[model samples]
Target: MSTLPAYVVFGEALTDFIRQSDGRWAAQPGGACWNVACVGVRLGVAAGYAGSVSNDLFGDALYMLAAEAGLDMRFTQRFDAPPLLAMVPSTQPPEYFFIGEGSADLRFDPDRLPVGWRSAAQILHFGCISLAREPLASKLVEVALAAHLAGKRIAFDPNWRNLMTHAAYRDTFHVMAGITDYLKVSDEDLQHLFPGINQREAIAHLRALAPFAQIMVTRGAAGMSLFCDGIEYTQPAFPVTVADTVGCGDAAMGGWMASLLRQPDAAPATHLRFAAATAALVATRTGAYAPCWEEVSSLLAQQITESPHAQ
Candidate 1:
């Protein structure tokens, strides 16, 4: 607990206002990077979110939740700027707009991070709209690039959004994807990232972009596919009643990374199954729910008990 966390996730921490089917809006503590970090921590990983948030109640909630989840609070910063917000007016792809003209996420200063964070962490994660904004985006890119150059593991997930269609964001995406050691993208993201291209071509492009990286593509309820070591591995999604798909991808990424770090030499198939189960648990709950390690293991064990050969 005295040392830095092994997992460091950098990006925005915002409140999501998802409109419900009943014509009402629900507020949830969400943001791709923030949720991923919290998921790792809750999944029994030494993780922390390396970002800044407003010092108001919204950020206060995020801060308190992360702290209670056992994230080392030394890496997160607080600013007096307005809190960032995501207004999701629709579902299926989670269409939303940002309200961060001067949000605290924009004020994240890498210079203020703990002195030894760069060398201490095992993996540094970045993605989502965090790479869409300026100043902070460029700074995050620099941080990621530096981490890669130093031989530290770097994980990236484009986490597509409407704002990512910008020409500028395209350049940023390629830069991050190219340097990342681990790249995680969803089926929806592939369509947005490589418009007019087929899945095979898009994946080929990603392989060319990050030749040495282990790439993972999530296929919603269908399951997930992985391309690693010049081979392909697939894992089926665990059957679970649907609640909402929000944060499912983050759960997968967090679960994958947690298993990778915790299990060390576990097979890629086992890791994928672990991740799929972690995400499945989250889909049974609303918001960016962080499933604990016990719940995930229980689900996996129950699956084995129910159908020994299915897994």
Candidate 2:
């Protein structure tokens, strides 16, 4: 039998049709949770993905991409439903349009999960549209709660989208937040949850819900902040030439989990620093590809040389 994965991600796997300003388009296979699994694999973590993929060309490509990234697909489901599509504007976040009412990625069946999968993984990651809609949404919660009860760490990155009704988002938010062991939230995600609030207030709100969870809030260019057990740590973003912002947060979350899993005794500050460096490297490139460990180290070395106090 094959070795079990250390990390398992449950979410959607879909395509993004990014429209360029010059009338060209690029189709990419990316979903927030899918990115976490792929990036974790690329960062040398044993990761598995539990999501639905259509049997279409795009779905085939995404499946191959996951395989290439060294992710275990034993729990991946395939269906006849068409792949989900998103219209990504060059200047704005991607706007999703479900290709078919019953898309493959949204058809995840919790009852059909691989036997012993709960004990096979050390951590279960959740986020994105998988937590927003129907049967799948409820199923995801059921699985997450099971994992938590089984003593597996739960990592979440809400990756909130307006496509989900405010009520749905609120409910999902509280349920996951209550049980999350490691959480990655963005300023944007918080703003959507609590309108017109500043970062401190947002953190306070999240802390009240998940008091013991190690929460990391990504603050774009200003960098990220960490809160755990009444203590807070902040780290500035690594200085890097910008390429595009695509997959930046996913990379950071992936790196953070990878670092923590490997060095369980490391401080939260150490984890955030490594994660920030990984995110900076991804920002210096295009697409959702993960950076090699050396790449992140080299960037960190340079940052340390340039700014003695950095990281």
Which candidate leads in TM-score? 1
Give TM per candidate.
0.95, 0.94
Write one digit per residue (lDDT tens) for candidate 2, span 145-235.
Answer: 9888889999989887766655876788899999999999889888887778887888888888986699998988988888876777788
Clashing pairs in 1: none
User: What local lDDT does model 1 show for residue 12?
Assistant: 85
Candidate 1 residues lying further than 4 Å off, grouped into runs, are 304-311
> What lDDT would candidate 1 get against the real structure?
0.89
Per residue, candidate 1 scores C-alpha lDDT tens digits across 14-55 of 998889889999888889999999999999899889999999
Model number with the top lDDT: 1
* Runs off by more than 4 Å, candidate 2: 93-100, 305-311
